[model samples]
Target: MNEQLLKDLLNQDLDPVETREWIESLTAVIGADGPERAHYLLERMVDETRRAGGHIPFQPTTAYVNTIPPQREAQSPGDAAIEWRIRSMLRWNAMAMVVRANRKPGELGGHISSFASSATLYDVGFNHFWRAASAEHPGDLLYIQGHSAPGIYARAFLEGRLTQEQIDHYRMEVDGKGVSSYPHPWLMPDFWQTPTVSMGLGPITAIYQARFCKYLEHRGLIPESDRKVWCFMGDGESDEPESLGAISLGGRERLDNLVFVINCNLQRLDGPVRGNGKIIQELEGVFRGAGWNVIKVVWGSYWDALLAKDTSGKLRQLMMETVDGEYQNFKAFGGAYTREHFFGKYPETKALVAHLSDEDIWHLNRGGHDPHKVYAAYHAASAHKGQPTVILAKTVKGYGMGEAGEAQNITHQQKKLDDSEVRAFRDRFKLPLSDEQLADVPYYHPGEDSPEVRYM
Candidate 1:
């Protein structure tokens, strides 16, 4: 931990053993891969070493990313190309910092620092897909943005195709002509957590609970209604004290319309005693037991089928029929507890009945819960009735960052990336030669601002 030792470590020559250790450690922190374009951060590590006034220490192994499933036997044909395009573009965004850093070293290192916040990701994510989704199935999503995430989101959407109305609204505010500036560089919605949490949760966490109730009542998905509301979340927000408790309450209240998509890859906010230990342990199991449909898609699997064009059609069809608000109750178990057998256990635990004549998902007109029974009653009542909802996904921490040595937690993440490691990762993103490709391009950096935003 001393400066000399740290410097020495930075200067150390790496072997296969050391290289593997370094990559795994990075993956644990970044969660998915740092950037798919990079097999290793080659140039950045050297830059980091030079900045440290030492030699680069850690190195990367010769490995390839395999985040996607093969498209050979797929019902879809273009899924493969689309999948790769997505990966490459995401990776391109990741290195936006380094690519832009040369203009202003360390100034525009926005993606990593800016991205860990749930608010920022939400806004950016919206910008990334608004054109495709909103233009297509307008009714399917009513995306909400409150804090830091929404600001990024708003900007991202504007960048895609700026409009006079939209631009006028946000620009007035960021500029003096408006009222307040966007929350911090990052915004934390109502339930957002601020720095420091050693004691426990406070007011920010309170409103989060209140809004959950309101949002669910207002916009929740009904089996027959065919609507879905997604709450974009950050690592800090994910750790909110009341979050899981509220999610359980949602299930208890039969709010199957609510879907929680948590971004869990950031290491800075994810302390050890929390992130994987408590957060994942609780959410991964919480709602499934209480009559909720949970789908945990991690790695490249995060929000894929639902957002994809070719697959979106099938996804919508499956979801609509599944929730057609018939005359029966059903329980869906996905993620960790998924199996083919839960389909039959309904006969004994039938505590509820479906009575609705309208279209709805999990449309329960009547149900009886034994005061003596625990969540088991709800579990049985749900899984027994309707077509039965299913939790489609769950992911391992750091799904494909390629790190295996360290536990995916915060304490380790607090440490800085060494020079050699940075360089290795930067170089790994180098694109293959193409005769027709443009001659002028930009460099990739992990901690620099984006050139794509400027001199494009």
Candidate 2:
């Protein structure tokens, strides 16, 4: 296409028919080598127009973006209010964890990023599991990966379980620490009930608990329906031999009341876990072979439309074939770097995602953050009979911690949040307070009479 023709297309407001003709003409000029080639040529033409001081009209469209579920969107006033309240709670809970960690130095509550993701995942499962099984008889919640006790603490604090004084004294370096840094069954309050001895014991203990429940049921003690146990473990924890060692017991005992929710954050304390890209696949095989049901929760709805367009399966390959290191780089560098690295690895994907903006790609669906998907997976696990169920939920290690820790390998031990980062966090969450007010009342309570506060 000549510079003159490009200028003409950019200058005039064309009708739909005229725009279609322009596109055809441009396509013919570029030759139908492939959709990628045509797209590249068009982009090059647009860049040339911009360099020549002409603004090419690039109208953004959601056609390429996945339509999020109605629950995810605030469609009505009530919906918006509720959504706003939820977001505030998440932000508040996250900040409370970090701030408390910062205040009580050497107490080691600073798994802010992990705690953030953990809180979200637990929040979704808590309501469902509580209503499904716990309300009648006390259900077991085993904390296999106990480093995230602060996350649960934050949630409990928000829900009025922890008093302002209790929140203030959490993990204090001094004598009288209200809460332990790790999830200790004897230390923390309700909801965060069970504690594990070591890294890989969650599933093992859960299986035994379910078996014991079966024994009780057989003896005409507790009902079989109230025998549920939910075990929360991390991806890194899954690597331990003991993690899968007793998993066979579930099948042998037919512990249908047992459920394991694996937080697949893709990183260990040292670095990314081995076979990172294939951990879920490997776990699926192990569980299936052991006579258990496995549910792999990977990408969210964001990739649905894009994947549907790729009939040849190249995009799917790109998604699965990319090494774990590449995903680490994506979290470290952000969208532009990942786009270049990802497309460079699989050039065939250019045709699939070429039209998408950097923001669109960056905002791709993550299963951990999607409450709907998490809730659904929990519901499915609850309903499954015979063998136990495992939910492999994909999540970022340091999600929502901003550049401080998100997806960074070293985030596991990253406990301190600096002043500037704290400010940014506060602003991002839109807390209704000034810096002075935030400092004055770190544990601000909503008005007692307010429905929002009462509801929480």
Candidate 3:
């Protein structure tokens, strides 16, 4: 969970004293029965610097100090500077631990051994599945669920299809000195992301957001013979008028080989609520009425909930009969998995992913790709549409990040960890991967598929 979550302040946005006033108000609203209710507001102050990318706003209310460590624990000039190097290594390895913990071997195509190196968790997850499956099933073009057209664009950038420098230029730096990344420093995201933040809500910009998808629809970006496109966009974006218009037009114009993933973060602004979080359910209703092939996957908090509910017979009916495999390929991706509960996910390659021990499962499907559920929907849609498929993944926001709440907290970013803290986090969270262990880990190539892969 080595990332931040955004908290949306409603009604009146506060500043310092004003913020304190609101915290008191919120505390009252939460009432005495709610334990530590004030913590949420107080917590906001600790991470202000993260608000605009990294232009740190100096630590919030002084009262926050007790709850969190001092931001400027002015050490003796001799002490803090001296430990900087050691701290840096720890931070680097800590990040690597998160990366490694997230992926089994080969998920990222190779043993990056460090998050400090330039690879994303999505990349790791996608490649891991691809490589693992390729060992058994060759010729499967690695199909993926994109969170947004930008995500697909980002993948293209990662695959060496785009240069690092260009992507950096395209990206805006949120922090003071732009952003700094390690392990192949140049491979930063081409954009800075703030929750629910966007350039515009207009059709043109919506179209821009859906840009890569247009290429996907027209068979413009990819080669037709190879596998088609799998595009991922967030839940909010799923409802954009322009996106819907594009899909309708594409369908009317006969766009094939496109897979859409509407990642349901269960949110509107900060995020959607639990239980009824997915946006696709509504969209599915519309798409189906239009004679479009769509599959709806309402999954549970763990793989078991999903697998238990998703009996093989139901899956066959969904994939083989519902949509009738119309387009040769069409799918929807959704499930409840989160990294918090199941980090370093390596699900049992057998059908009983539901029954496996917590230790054996590699996925924490809080919100990420669930190949089984998603691919089943893809099968259904592909068969029904008579066109290749779009596996629209309804996923959770902040899928792999540390914070589990809908609010991506800014305070949790570990900019620095003293000796005691660093040691503890290391021992508790990140262990190391062995050479032999690494060799057998899942490796991500591309277009690889597996029916019996373990999924926890």
Candidate 4:
């Protein structure tokens, strides 16, 4: 290709169709010649464009879609029906534990939104990704977020690792039998591994842990193994300097054993983490610039059909242009508002979703909540080498909490749910509890012979 002709083409204001054709042609030439030659030419073009002060259009670092294409994604090995049933049971117990504690005279409070938001994130790991320590191999290390401890406890109860007495004593650690609100190695020395109750400790420590593993392997202190360090944190937690301070070290050291999963629920304790901006895009640029593998799990499987139909790119353009504040409101207000405002702005975008009902539109989930999408990202990260990996997963703050707190600014402090909210939650999770059983917001456990129990 001639340099001047390439410059002229770059300067032209081509529409989406023309741009697509130009890219396809360029890709064909690259494929015929070989990718290495094309890479050299592209680098030269970038340098020349900078020297000439000419504008160059680059692809966005991330897209409003899953990092892995549907065809390339691996199928989840676990049975979906059994896994969902187990997740529903855990979600109910976790919520019930917090609500029951607050009803006491002391009004002992615990975080509801964090766990509600991240239940699927944890559930996926438990079922497939995370492994236990054994004589043959070292196990994966997890740094659970401080606020999401309740969900872990609920899982333990179902596994028979925790007793009902411990479940009842949430946030009242003074008693010998009571459980601590956050992960504490001292309180539960036999169970909890790392202490992450402090806001920014998890991320920094997890990075060093991965680095330390490499150090031990090089020193011949431990056998060479594929153990991984999994760090889970909130989007708001990233604001703490400690959370992102050591990410550069991870990339520089080529710590392929490390995987950081940041749950972006949008809302922090007070309000939106970045109401005016896109946090996922910002983080993507930072990680990619640092020479780390970045996988974005933005939209869920529910969006596959609509995204496929969005040939004009208008729908995606709207998704990119919308701010976090508006996204939060769309979920809070429901499907009607989302269709009216999100799609209402452009007739072409509106028509793309015309076949779906308001209810269908409302249930369109974020990527973090879907097990298949989460599994794909995890599987990819585990297999990727030569760099660290970060999965920026988008989720709803108060995920199944209904009007009590879902997507509301008051989520962090929402410790108790009313009778109607409890009933709604039970129904949403498809729990077997009747209205009468839900009256007390009691903890539920399937018998030992039940499929859920046997599957676990």
Error of 1 at 158 (Å): 11
Q: For model 2, what is the C-alpha lDDT against the true structure? A: 0.67
Estimate, for each residue in 28-79, the C-alpha lDDT of model 4 and write its tens digit.
8677996667778778979899889988876448666678877779889999
Candidate 1, residues 302-347: lDDT per residue as tens digits? 2232224322133333322332111011222121121122212242
Model 2: CA > 4 A from native: 1-84, 104-109, 132-144, 173-177, 188-192, 275-277, 435-441, 448-456
TM-score of every candidate relative to the true structure = 0.37, 0.76, 0.37, 0.92
Candidate with the larger TM-score of 1 and 4: 4
For candidate 3, the TM-score is 0.37
Global CA lDDT computed for model 4: 0.90
- Where does candidate 4 have its weakest 10-residue lDDT segment? 2-11
Can you tell me which runs of candidate 1 are displaced by over 4 Å? 1-78, 97-159, 162-225, 234-236, 266-270, 273-279, 297-456
Lowest lDDT block of 10, candidate 3: 60-69
Tell me the whole-model lDDT of each prediction, alpha carbons only.
0.32, 0.67, 0.34, 0.90
- What digit string (tens of lDDT, one per residue) describes model 2 on residues 228-332? 688888878887888888888898888888888888777887688753465666666778778887776676657667777876556776766766666777767
TM-score of 4: 0.92
| The candidate that achieves the highest lDDT relative to the unseen native structure | 4
